[model samples]
Target: MEMIYRPLLPATQYCPCNWQSDSTSLHSLPQSKHASSFLRTLIAPYAPLWVNSTPATTDNSSDDLECPQANINYRSAFEQQKREAAKKMDATTLMMSLYVPKGRWQWTYQVPFENRPEEDPVTSNRIWSLSVRTARIYNESITYICKLYPREVQWEGFFSEVKLHKTQLRPLHGASTPALIGIQSNITGIQLAYDIPHHSFWIQASPDMPDILKRRCLDAYHQLHAQGVLHGNVDLANILIGGDGRVQIINFHKSRSTKNDPKVHLGLATPQDFNMEMREVHYKLNYLGAREKERAVWENRRNSRQTPSRRTTRRRDKDPYAIPMEPPTDPVRWLIPDNWKPKRFIVPGQSREQFEYHLRQFLLDLEKSKIHSPSEGDKSQGPNRRPPGDRSPPPTRCDLGKRKRGEVDSEDDDDDDDDDDDDDNSSSKRVRFLAQTNHDDGSKGKVRSPPPPGVKRQVPRISREYQNFGESPKTFAIPFISS
Candidate 1:
């Protein structure tokens, strides 16, 4: 029997057939005939056909074997083409539905585009074709982010940013900031790719962040400022904090570069001509001012020993300057002490700079006062006068020890006796020294004393000369009546 094999059907269309044949000994039949029958049974649905004919070995080997090989090659090529076509269709469908580029970044379409309700009608109506979209991506491991943006928005600002990030800001790769990866512009739309950060900007205000991380955020801003870039939108939402405690400044589409045109405003309320450094200083000063206000409030509460009401606490929760109640454990805490009171100067119609200058002066004066002023109890005393009861001991007489030794000559003894007699008299008199006063009336250079009972008192005249007599000076008054 001669066997005739039909062309194989496509893999998708092929099916198996159930055929039960009785077990028969085929050893009596020819080898070729037995092989053909077994093959036909094996492929019953699309089996080879057997015909009674004389078998020609040479022609069969050349024509039949070559034809089957050629057919196999053709079938493989057709299937490969079909597979390639299906893959392309899938990619096209994904692009159309999700509006994202293919390869490496598979869009999960989980996060929706956010639009502020407070936006103006013109701004609201202006379709934001280039929106952030979330995607699941794996470089070494899987990551999720909403950092995708469309490239073909036909906006000059977008194109400028694309060029800037690609050329100048290339060194910022793998940082907390978004780095440009790829751009695809086709009939559908433009797609600008970026490396997604691990954390979003919304988590910056979380109380769980350590002081070190907050400082890192400040450092990131400084770094950007050093690069002559001003982050026009410097809200908390634009400052991203990564899982590794890394900080990044993003949303640079509205950023202004001092290296470029300094006059460009870039949607910020700051002066158009201000450089990046100036803008950075302004931000720092504003932050310091807000911190001072918070410090003042905390100080007042602490001094008053009052706990914030629930309503006040809730109100403060919405305050942009509000910080964690636990004091910061960093060097910056020293600069913004909880006891610090903001003595900002206010002039009714003064310019901002003038007001700030006055505030600076107040701070300087406060520091000076801390250094030079006396304690609270001693402040009432005049500058020259020592505190009461802090008098120095009376001057010791040099001859006092010699007088007590009893070794003096007669003349010395007489003088010593006279001095002893004067000292004794003065001790018994109970004299008190009072401050000299200037009188506005005609009676000047006169010491007044309280009159004793049944005695008229007179003002004593000032005397410049001292007499050798054992008598008290005219300025001194004796209460006892002398006989």
Candidate 2:
């Protein structure tokens, strides 16, 4: 079991939103020149003294430029509201604005021990110990999460993470991972701020977890490896699911860079480190899916055992249009007459009445086309029937000679009349015969007999038969003509 740290120091109640120039919320904050610029920008509107005064440089040996000392006390107005109006306030009221671009932070004090929810035991303890809270920048609307660490236990971890963020992890800021805001060091502890989205949450496995999200998580790891950074703990807790469906990697305290870390560069297993992290991610994702599936199975079993009929009724009541999973006990309950049309047949992007109107129109057009179609007697003569006035030339000597030589098959000669009768009909046998004849003529360089003058070659028609209704619909072949 992991040891949970509980800080003895009381949680800070200071909120940046209420900070004023004369306010003493911050005390003796030691920041580098780079961090000072960011700090100045954050407090410029609230603290005129810090902004107008010359910035202090922590990089140099000089101590003259250090920040002014102010009396610090933790007393949050929000915390007071939670204490006074716990019942009236919604639990998610604070979390709702977490990712909202307020250009400012709404810092809520840490959860009190007595009021902490049972579900978030670790969260409360961690927040209390780390002094983790939200912050607001003077002119910045983006919310930033801040974490304070005891100088003795977490200072080393703080500096290591900051170095990686400023170096190899810099490019991944606001993309695959949160961007570091700045760092503040005082005699008490070290504080590191980051621009994490308000809507970001830790990864949790679910049965309906999208494969795209899993792929994104894998891609994030690949990117980290490509940057020569190895996240020592590649667990699910360290992964964040963003509001925009992006996967973000966090908690770089244990991360190492092969480029920056001498130990990583010298290690023989360095190459396998990247592969191991990738495998771990895949395994964890698969495990989460399996766990969720098992949980669902258990829930279904419990529900079925408790109230099978009630559940079924509830499902039917919720979605009346939903298809029944099980057949009705009495067939008459579901069976409908051939002419009957369900009142609620749905068509997407259109109303039921509009869809029904269009369907009736289609059926009317189909009926009209069938009535105007060629008669059976005319169809039996083939669609290629020539006009009565047109006449064929008398058989030439060359044609008579070929016929006498038995070039044409006897079976074809016998079926000539029958083939002509069925020429308008769509059948597989007729299609095959035409295809075979074409193939043979092409391969053997045999020229087919020429057609009568003014007549064209046969064109296959697009025919579709609808047999979904009680009776089969007649095949309506529409001949496709080339442009």
Candidate 3:
């Protein structure tokens, strides 16, 4: 996932808005270094530090550069990213600086979580714990999610295990990223951070672990065959869940089938149809058959025998700035009304990368098993019993300690109460995602945003389509959240 950015390019260099490239092709980059440099110079007043700082290393393989252990490298990248993000005062700041230069669509505005009435669970024997939401993932080019935890007893390890898995549909919104998020400790609470606008996403752990992100995981699998990339997990929660039932996907399609680890089991698997690219690299090393001439011949025969790219599969002659299409005729259309929408960015506050991991397991099922699915492999019946949380990394801080019985006090006394609703904890459904209509006028219209965090906590259940045959328990949202 870190490799998504060319090693030394600044954030603007690989900005999505600069040019819309075929999502499946690595060769179709959005901008060149020279163009990016010019864009940076123009926007420097709004952004002082958004320039290329990747050390000029000849290695070319970011994977080999002390990735997991290189805490210093990760920290350096993060600080640099932060200095670049401070210019965002309002929508125009991002539009002029980040989105336009990059050439992709830019989506902004707080999602339902902004109104969540609750605070992170406060407790000092807290069997349950929640990670700090970074307090600042709202803006940033880099993101980090922890993936390890240790419990005093293995049973704590078990339930804590049940707790941290992003697969379970706990609609609790906090910090998360597109590629990965997790922790490895007995403590059940862990926090993650990410860059929503950038296609390149990251988590602090597992080069292979990013596959577990909700959106990327499922999206990667959904188009595996067309992209010449193999799809792995394809469950509902594995991808980003939006306000209007739209789903966005991620997770590297290049490395699923051959990469499963025998020791971790995680109950993860993929459908059989997924295939890797002939020129793909894995774990920073190339894994295709050796001998360039023989490899070329092999790919030719392979491409000849496989299915042709589908009509639904869209490719571009040159990089386009956005996903374009004629306006859809539907009067109820939220944004542009047409099949011409560019792929939607994963909605903020929802974890799509996590869903992809679960979905990969499902995709393999589609390939290996003979089940018929409503979509890809939706099961008509209840899901097969599997381990809870589908092999998520253990929680590094899995407990919220103990909370007082009186902790559920009303929020009428809180310092800030703007648009805050006081809901009877005993009654009211949790709003899972945001839903609203907006005109180009930028007026705040009616919105069905989620309840505040203080309201009765809603436990998210994986959509039935992904419970088993789909197997991804990640959150799914309303189809259109962007305006």
Candidate 4:
């Protein structure tokens, strides 16, 4: 309950408009164990001083095999690695169809998701360092990870609009997944980057791979709700294992089609890139506000892509329990702390409208030796803007860092940010989340929103920014079903 994270400095100067200004080119995705000089920089740029946990890696035996004795488990060694990924992608697309080699697919050692370089877990001291992405798969890839899943569930019943019941026939219901008619891009079509691999998991390659790996995320969430369409970006990195029993659910971008009945893939273009990753997990758990906006927008978009996320750090990256400032009350992903503080502004060539808020208040006082060390009754509940020394960092490992805030009534809706809803629909009665939704005396129900649950409400300005890039960034939807 002390949130305010903003740590990312890959050699400073600032970098996120997209990152990747050709740093010796970029390469490390073809099977990626993780080294090419640690991907070139920020493997885990001190994972934002812990921010409430997620930097503990001692994990080795997900079956353990480094290279031979093929017992298998990365979901059946990924279903014989997806039938040998179509025979090694048909002999490497027939040896790149005999082409010479022009950026081959743009692999010039492209560093910057914080410098990179962190894939060493075979011998002993084990080092992962965090910083993931590359999970593409239909063609061959798998490593995508953005972080900030501090919690999930209840973005209005996980993609709400009142049980989603759009009918006209509901796009004729699941025509085979794909929608995005009409394209317009101020850029950002996957290039926010990562060419694809949004998700893929069917694994069968063997030794029971984590019980058939979550049975392919509950059989792709019951096969996208039996194809009426509403997978609305399921979770655990959109679920993936793809090798044989192919239990998959790769990103339809945001997938909807509950019943307008055009047969399913209405037209297809991107629907705003599948509603920005199914509404960016409903604004980082909006109902809980994306569990602290995925921990302050991935620590401010990966610390503004510490030089385009080139990421780096030797050992001491610390995850003592990451406590940045927000997320930890646990009533299902806590988020009403109310301490905000830094909201000054003025970035135009940095004449310094307070010099980036005193360099973010001297990195929030050098992040008090880095917190997230919480536990002993959460350090007698003492740490606030987190500084006074070791108060958290001891959770993330296996359960994968602080997760439980899931099962709510209904709370997942998207489109996200750039919003500004005033709301007053004449006594209101809108529930249009289309998938099957039909309550209010109709059928599928659940509707109530009053800051009740154990009571603790305050967080109102969920978002607001005006650095003036020509001005325009307000976003506020908040509509997932109520009356």
Candidate 2 vs candidate 4: which has greater lDDT? Answer: 2
lDDT of 3 by residue, 80-172 (tens): 777655533343232223211110112222211121122222111333232222222233323222222223323232222222223321122
TM-score for all models, in order of appearance: 0.30, 0.33, 0.20, 0.18
Q: Per-residue CA lDDT of candidate 4, range 1-483, in tens?
A: 222222222212432322223331213223244432212121111111112245689867757747557564687777887897777556544422322111222231222232122321111111111123332222332233221111222121211211232222123222212111111111111111211121211111111123223323444444455545555544433343331223344333344554532333332323343334333333322322335545554565445542123233522333222222222122333222232111111111222222323333333433442344334333323223344464455455633422333211122334342122213321232432222455344446445445767998654442122223244566545433432
**Per-residue alpha-carbon lDDT of model 1 for 1-483, expressed as tens digits?**
222222222212222321122222232323354443222222122211122356567656664565543335778899999998887666545543433322223332222222211111101112133233332222222212222333334443554455446444555545646655444333344445454443211123222223334445555765665555666655444555442345565556666665564333333323332333333322333332434544554676667655453354322124222234333122233232233221111112223333223323333444454455444344333234454565544435755564454323235358778688656644433232233455544343534445779997564553333222246544644344343
Measured by lDDT, the strongest candidate is 2
Sort by lDDT, top down from the best: 2, 1, 4, 3
Total colliding residue pairs, candidate 4: 128
List the candidate 3 regions with Cα displacement exceeding 4 Å: 1-132, 136-177, 181-233, 241-247, 250-256, 266-483
What C-alpha lDDT does candidate 1 achieve relative to the native structure?
0.39
Of candidates 4 and 3, the better by lDDT: 4
The Cα local distance difference test for each model comes to 0.39, 0.43, 0.28, 0.31
In every candidate, how many clashes are there? 0, 8, 116, 128
Best by TM-score: 2
